[model samples]
Target: MTNLQKAVILITGASGGFGQELTRQLLEAGSRLILTDINEAVLRQRVAAIQNEVKTGEVLACLASDLADVQGCETLYHQVKALDIPIDILINNAGVGLFGRMDEIPRQRWEYLMQVNLMTPMRLSALFVPDMIEHQKGHIVNISSLAGWCAIAGMAHYSASKFGLRGFSEGLFNEVKDYNVKVTAVYPFFSRTPILQSERFGTLAKTYQGLPEHMITDPADVMRATIQGIVKNQLHVFPDPTANRLHLLQRYFPQLVYWINNRMGRSMKHG
Candidate 1:
């Protein structure tokens, strides 16, 4: 099992709902943390709060850097490198969501989403993997979503980004397994997180309206399962029960899953 105590972890998107929850839990587990977010004030506030609550683990650094561009990624890497801390784990939890028909969504918005959700993780991994390989130990966690496994309407761009993340995580896991490095791709269904509060387009909000209240998972529960998955070195994690069941169905009954999603897509369009 991976020991989080004293482990130095770098978490992107540290100001978001899921990111904050993960930070809380990992800090409680006695892991040193480096938190990064685009919002400098918010990130500092979060670090201060965690410091107040948990006294065991150190909050090494709180960085405010955009992950939506290559330059931002490079800046963060250089900043962390300057600190001289060897990250034992890297959590690529930063992402953005775009909701609308493929044609209706602005090209720039979806492009930004892809950059933040897909390219940022790849870039960050490229920066840290070499050290992890040299040390022969580390873990990388990528927060993907259920949309990656089962695509639906009004989420064409969002789903594509998540799909790309999952694919990259899987490939990276295989590539680095021999070095004793673990990679986990977390696939959570809709969660009660700030991502849900992101601006919606067209009928996308209407589509979410159709989902049952119980369908939205809790951020804390998802983070708990995510931590467990990290400790056990699981390659793929379905943090919510619905996500796990959906993954099983997608595996055993691909056509059925496709048909169900197709029907849901039609409902979203008609309503």
Candidate 2:
């Protein structure tokens, strides 16, 4: 794989756990990043830290915008064009999660998750694909999860969003492969991130109750795997060993996976 040195990359959710780590690695790898997140203050703080660390690699701009609204996505496109920064890699990493049974999660909350996790990526891809086409080179990386392939009780909505994202990423990959544009969808297992605190998964909640902090993978690992995938132009990336094993199990012994997941769910609930 050829090096994508100083590639202009746009990352959403720049203030969150994975986003922050990703920014750090991209800077270290000599990539010019345009960071954006809903939280303006955190975004500013992240950008400042990166600026202080690297005098040479570029930190293009940090803008604040909510990606749930389609109009906001349109505004983001306009803002990027106005800045005249060439976006060589687009990381659709902004997403939210809800941990509840299908009927337990509120309609608005479910919709919001869908908007952020599934819809926004497609909207941003649509906006950027033309430019990539014109330039005849680009890469799109969608951050998905292990939930996308396997079912987890109480996280129905969250799983649905990731499952949808996986499908979208796969379809987009095929569509753009002939255009000299590469697309990679990543699936990772549980990580020590703020998103875990944001969800209320009935079964997983119990398991997490007494879990050691070190048991979860670090956000930096996720960031590193994502970067490695983009650099290698891989189609599917499993960022963690556990996530990779689960994915493999799902591929060949789905019934066994179902049994194992169900047993785990029961154990968590009973614990």
Candidate 3:
């Protein structure tokens, strides 16, 4: 079991609903936290709120840095390293979503989503994995999405980013398993997070409006499952029931999965 007590964990996008919930749960479990987000004020506010409640583990530092650029990723890494704290666990939770047709979505937005969702994790992992290897211990959690496994309309770029992340996480897991470093890829279905408030392009707003609200998972439940996965050293985590069932179905009935997604897309387009 991974002992979080006194373990230094760095969580990106700590101000978001899922990220904030994860921060609270991890702190309650006695993990030292170094939280980061693009919005410094909001990140620090969340940190203060958690400290006011749990008051157990240390909140090492709450630094805000944009992770959508390589320099930003490097800066965050160096900032943490300068503090002389060995990050025992790194949670790559920062991500953004752009909803629209593949052709209609601007290239700039697609690149931004890819940078934040895929490249940032890869960059951070590259920077920290060596240290974990030298110590022969550490954990990295990449917050991928259900879209990664199953392609869906109106989320082409977002799905691509997550799919890349899923592959990277799996490859990293194999590469580091022998060295005792664990890489967990979390595939959560839509959650009731601010990410749902993502910018909608083309006809995405109309499509999203037709989606069932009940389908969205709870951030708290997702965070609970994530912490459990981390402790158990799970390589692939399907936290939500919907995602788990879909993942199994995709494995057993690939054609059925494609048909369902195609049907959903048609319905959204017509509705």
Count clashes in each candidate, considering only residues at least 3 apart in sequence or on different chains: 0, 0, 0
Clashing pairs in 3: none
Expressed as tens digits, the lDDT of each residue in 195-239 for candidate 1 is 876767664565555455566889999999999999999999999
Q: Output candidate 3 Cα RMSD.
A: 1.5
C-alpha displacement of 189 in model 3, angstroms? 0.2
Q: Name the better of 2 and 3 by lDDT.
A: 3
Which of the numbered candidates is closest to the native, going by highest TM-score?
A: 3
Query: Per-residue error at 246 for model 1, in Å?
Result: 0.2
Query: By lDDT, highest first, what's the ranking?
Result: 3, 1, 2
Over the stretch 1-271, how does candidate 3's per-residue lDDT look in tens digits?
7888899999999999988998899888889999999999988887888789887888889898999999999999999999998999999999998888888888998999999999999999999999999999999999999999998888889999999999999999999999999999999998999888788887665656645667678999998998899999998999989899999989999999999898877766665
Best by lDDT: 3
Model 1 off-target regions past 4 Å? Answer: 203-210, 262-271
Tens digits of per-residue lDDT, candidate 2, 1-271, equal 5255788999999888898888888888888888999988889987788678866668888888889989989989988898997789999999887776787667888899999999999999999999998898899989999889997777788898899989999999999989999999999888888887776644355444422445479889877987888889998999989889999999999998999887766654654
